[model samples]
Target chain A: MEERKAIVEIKNVNKIFGENHVVHDLDLTIYKGEFLTMLGPSGCGKTTILRMIGGFEEPTGGQILVEGERVEDKEPFERNVNTVFQSYALFPHMNIWNNVAYGLKMKKVKKEEISRQVAEMLQLVRLNGFEKRYPSQLSGGQKQRVAIARALINRPKVLLLDEPLGALDLKLRKEMQLELKNLQKKLGITFVYVTHDQEEALTMSDRIAVMNQGYLDQLDTPERVYEKPATKFVADFIGESNIFEATISHMTGDTASIGLEVGNALCLLEKGVSYSLSEMVYACVRPEKVLFSAGEAEGFNIKGVVKEQIYVGNIIKSNIIIANGQMVILSRLDIDEVPKVGEAVNIYWNPDDVVLMKSRGYQIHHVIENASLGGD
Target chain B: MKRSYRARNKTIPLLTTVSPVAIWLILLVAAPLLYVLFLSFLSTDGYNVVFLFTLDNYKNLFNPTYLEIYANSFLIAFFTTAICILVGYPFAYHMARAGKRKKTVMMVMLMVPFWTNSLIRLNGWKTLLGKTGFVNTFLQNLGIIREPVEILYTRGAVLLGMVYILIPYMILPLFASIDKLDHSFLEASNDLGANKVKTFLHVTLPLTFAGIFSGSIMIFIPSLGYFFVSDIMGGGKSQLIGNLIETQFKAGNNWPFGASLSMMLIFLILIMVTVYKKSGGDMEDLGVM
Candidate 1:
């Protein structure tokens, strides 16, 4: 949250590979020393943007400025930027010390200096005494650490990481997430991190750029991006949400009365701009934000029948079908008494909890459904 | 007792399965090698083996006339391998980087020479490189040259023939190793402040050294021992160790000396192979170790 000037600026960059347009009209600015994560699904151009910054990819139609100078025509080695590739990309034939010292050696640094710096880098990555081992001998996490050390020893003004922890198991990935965050903070260098894992972005990034199908969907702080998603895609991607089609029936001052498409019940939109009367819209509310009551509550309320209840360790996840056969999912942990299947229940969400956005056509729901089908 | 019996029973099937290969190797490969080694220790008159134990065959190998032939053989083989590597590396690198369809087409083109026997291929080269061959005729007809030029039956012809047949050997292993190169390493090298040339030296070349070594060995070994190319293309002007040994066995009728020459070549090849193995090459890498 420091008042820092922008260190890297992308001006409407576009990347097209053959007929496949991978990145489209991307504009972004990364401030000094901030860990900015490009978070998206597999084909969302997050990696392409990181590569463009690292000089591995040249933008088709725009300029990238690093440290106030245009770098679109520069080679990766010509720019003051380095990348930690997703697969580690350690040289198999070189020992650990040589791998970390590769950039220094290429710069013709003195042998003793290279050795000292390499040792210091290894220690920084907590990989001391591993200089003699080849890359093949190291485990996945160790290889990742070596790759980080290798890229960091160059001391580039900007560091780009492309899913560097993707190969690690869940537990290791969590540990690495914290380590990378601390490393970035300690070095006070800008890091452009790319990953499809929303949890990782939320954990380490100062600001997260959410991408969808080669377009920037939303760029904001993790909390804001999660709680105040700008689009249906952002809401669906960041966390579990109960999203359904609706229409704005009426507006009173700043509040819009929305009619749910499935249940045909009216609910007040409390947190968003009021839409025109009879405009189609999308209604979204987080699963955890919804409170189930046996009777009425002081907020938007809908009645539904419990279709299934799933016990997922600490929390119970339940699916409820309203009278019109529309499904709404909610997770509850406070209730001691569990609801039985087929039991009629009232779902209550605060007015502020409901997010109303203009509908993005029919395929948006289909994409959300398919994406959630593949578990996080 | 039951566990030992079970282990012993396991060995019975393994042994039964492996015995055929062992027997075939001993009969076909080992027996001839041992016979040649035995013959190398005997003395030879001009007409027949004297059947007497002697070291004269190896002593005769040190003669300057025979030493010149060995040196020439080494020089030619070295040139052949060097040329194969110089030309084959870029071609193989391109093949490795090409799309799947182009790669298959290029590979098939490389193998087309093998469909016709190598001897026939060598003869085809001889015909093309002859004084009145296609090249000279084309040049003469194009008015580039006034008269036919001597193309075949020269040292250059011999080197060209050797390189032509052995180029595929160099290319295949190079393709295999280069294709398996992790592309990320090159990108990583570039990201680490190395340019294209530096990346190739530090990453690409060293990573694919195994292929270069194996391909060099493949070209060098055969170029040394296979003299038919030189015989057909060199026009009796260039005599290699293989031709010398062949002459000793046939025209000179000195089998012991020829056997000694064969033994020395085998010993040299074994040493090269042992060095390759010690330098980190494994049989599983390319079956060259």
Candidate 2:
């Protein structure tokens, strides 16, 4: 394995706007040539953290080091990064050619060199013939491409993107996500992308930093963040999961019998982590791990009546109302048999599938909001 | 006659919608201008305006004395526009970026003076800059000067008066334009490796050029005809086109000659307006409303 080099390091960063603490004591180190995404809901300080790195924002308290030099006191232009703003922010008064050429022109580059590099960048963004048109004359996607070209022409060490595809329609957004990912790989440049879209972060990031409530919840590969979230917020923020708030009724070696409102369930305890009797904990289980059966299954501890079933693309999602009237979702492959609503069903999962985590004192409303936002 | 019928149909709607403004313009604006044009080509017979066509009044415009007045008028207009831009751009720029509360207070500060009659305001300047005025008295009491500075009733005084009255016109449009500029553009420019000065030059100035053009047109044209300003401030020492035309009508008793001078001023303004439109200036950018 090659040694991972840290390109930008943020240590104990804090940002406050008026009285609201947008980011609190955030510590993140971005490696060179890796696509890192700060993923969270809006107002979760993801963009603030990215802005602090790009020098657009001054951290209230912290030191940000870019390539081993402190950059908090530097202006954005003096930093070694460029940003592709969400609005595109192409110079409205210049043609596409001049817009792409602006960075080199500002640096007083030679005319021929600027032209060559601008032409190459435009070609790279696949906007080859849009040189003469103003930004007003281009479509949303073309304007987006022009913005990327303009930023990339400077050849900075890192690129900061603040939801660059957020304004595009769904189809264009998907296409651009792939294009931007490929462009980053081809250029071998580090990208610090900020987005509230969890699916986008999952699809595009080499590592995802799940953030909420001004805290860095977890940073890991998308698979790990989705499967083994460090905090309850990361579990809920990622793809849909049913979280069980339960009290530890009994404990054994590497297993615990937790008493949930619905019923008692056997769950896995993290190795070396201790849990006493009646300690409150959150148990997260992916929907697909919970099975819905017409008849009582073996080792079935949770039972509920079928509330509703939805067909989502290739998967069938069933909501099972437990004995406590709490709806626990069960996602499965569409096997042509959805238990009728109001019918009884047995819901169960393997004990190891439940990942027990500490409760962060979040209420049920926050989980529901994140689930609905994920649906969007 | 189908085309004629179509035209009539269009006219019926236009008549209902636009006729009031059209009639107002033609009757009040065009009629007087046409009368002036008629008088400019006519002869005055012993205080009686005659309907005889003559170019004598217009040819008199080429006289060296009148030409010197035109040159002086140009110089005053140029200086007034230049000074207003130099002073107003920074104020407008700051106001545009200021917080809403501060911006509101500053906006009130800028507009409160103009709410009063401009003539009265210029008269206030007269008292302020007079020989025994507050400024002179302050300086004399401070012992900074043994004699009062001759600031009042000079060309500089009239120029100052013009700028004071017209700076709001400059600042309003420039403020609107600068405020309309997306703040993200500055961030983008800085992100693209341009410093503040470069960003301002390449982005801010180019985007707000329409405001400058509209403001210049507003200040330059009015400074030429603000006859009362020069009268009160310049002490009638140097002749301006406004004073010349005023003398022709009041003391010289040559309405035809005065009409000719007004027509020439109108011609100069027309050229200016055409240039403004060509450069993409709009009435909305002028912030007149």
Candidate 3:
């Protein structure tokens, strides 16, 4: 694919709050007219990155380029980026019309032109005939629409949204997410969205940047990020995955023979560093990719007993205990083919479905082990 | 039947909670106001007040001397309120926006003057502004004037005392209102491309107007009836409505006219309060509630 021209580029961005390092050396590029989302857990600096882009914060050491020009020192208004904050941040004193017209008024636009643009933007947000109502008088969804109208009225080069649907009910949030994505596509403006909801990121973003502990874990399309996570953290964070502790027995060409505690498994080495003989590593496979049966498969299958079975709507979630005693292996079965609890079963997965994660230091082993055990 | 019984039970606690306040209002507030309305129509014959309905007190209030006193009282009150707001607004705004430690310090400083009796503070001002007081002594030492200047026994001194006594009353309420303002609103204004002065004019001032109006009324109403400040500070030369009413009842021995004048002061306060409420500009919009 040809590289598109970057509408906004962040180079080596770092933000430190007193003693806490919030955003580490981060580099990213946002293409023009692309809907990009920064997805992370709370306190992972997603909003901080959005704030830096909106000129609400200054990078401790780095450069932020907007339209190929550095805007590190520019005030929020001086930049060609407008933000719709999580709180909506609507001016309570002004009615919807004035709230939407505020930016134009600041630019000293003609009164007639401002009214025209404000009315058009309000209509775009589907809030026609409610121009005279104050923000306090509006419902959460209406307030959110007004906020969008206010931000879009300026016709900025980039639109920054910091969890704009966070205050709405679940149904409204889902509806607004679709509306916001459609609006971004219709406007053809570069949208930099920040959200903690992985589902939201997957639903709306043309590309999603997964971050963890102030580091960019992976950045790719939603399908690629979900199907092929770059790290154990991303795999664990984005969706459910059944990870197995194993050691690389031998490496032959593009495949590595892995020895699981219960049995042997094969790992196709597609990315990351090479594995050595007897090197400890993690083999990760999605629950949906794991097949369960009452009898052992022809090859590379482990025998286990179904410990628990839960029917969750369309899917049956089953916890199977493999040969090494209490180590539970999670698998999702179709509701029509769910096995009963305490039934003997065999679990198997294709070699290509396994993802290899290089084991970190001994401390991280304890960390990951504790995390898997659900300990704080 | 059970639903009606449950509804009545729910209302019982609410009624019990309001009963004491309702009784207090009827006896203390409503009874005195009704008595004043009845007295306003009665005629005074020497020391005896007859219940015969007459408009004599209202008619006498229209006389030039009484009207002049009323006008002067208004003018003094207006000037005092204006001065109080000018001095109090910045002080209150500073207190509101200040850091926690600084805000606490400022609040203590504002309340310290009130801790001492108002009469004591007024006497302290008297000593400071007297002809042989510290101010005149310091100026004499500097040779700015050959002798002590007559700063006391003037309308200016009366205004000074009134403003000093009432400034905190204005500041406290204004601070309470302005402090509740969301700091994000100011940030939002700046983000929308407004300069600091423009933001203050379009956003800050209008939002804080409710507090300003309430504080102004609080200062103006009491200043209208506070006679001791003027009596001591103005040396009884510049008598206000308060002094006139006091003289009518005590020195002039005219109880009925004094009652009528007191009633007029209450009427003026009512009018001011009504106008304030009618303005309908709320502080909640400014995030100050």
In order, the Cα lDDT scores of the candidates are 0.87, 0.89, 0.85
Ranking by lDDT: 2, 1, 3
How do the residues B53-93 of candidate 3 rate in per-residue lDDT, one tens digit apiece? 87777778778987777777788999999998899989999
What DockQ would candidate 1 receive versus the native complex? Answer: 0.84
**Among these predicted structures, which one has the highest TM-score?**
2
DockQ of 3: 0.57
**B146-252 per-residue lDDT for model 2 (tens digits):** 99999998989989988998899899989989999999999999888788898999999999999898889888988888888899888888677888889988988
List ranges where model 2 is wrong by over 4 Å: A298-301, A360-376, B1-43, B51-64, B141-145
Candidate 3 or 2, higher DockQ: 2
Candidate 2 chain B: minimum summed lDDT over ten consecutive residues — where? B280-289
Name the candidate that leads on DockQ. 1
Chain B: TM-scores of all predictions: 0.94, 0.92, 0.89
Model 1, C-alpha of A201: deviation from truth (Å): 1.0
Q: What's model 1's lDDT at B111?
A: 89
Model 1, B78-148: lDDT tens digits are 99999999999999999999999999999999989867688899888867877788899889899999988
Could you estimate the TM-score for every candidate? 0.89, 0.90, 0.88
Candidate 3 segments exceeding 4 Å error = A257-264, A278-280, A296-307, A321-336, A362-376, B1-41, B48-53, B281-289
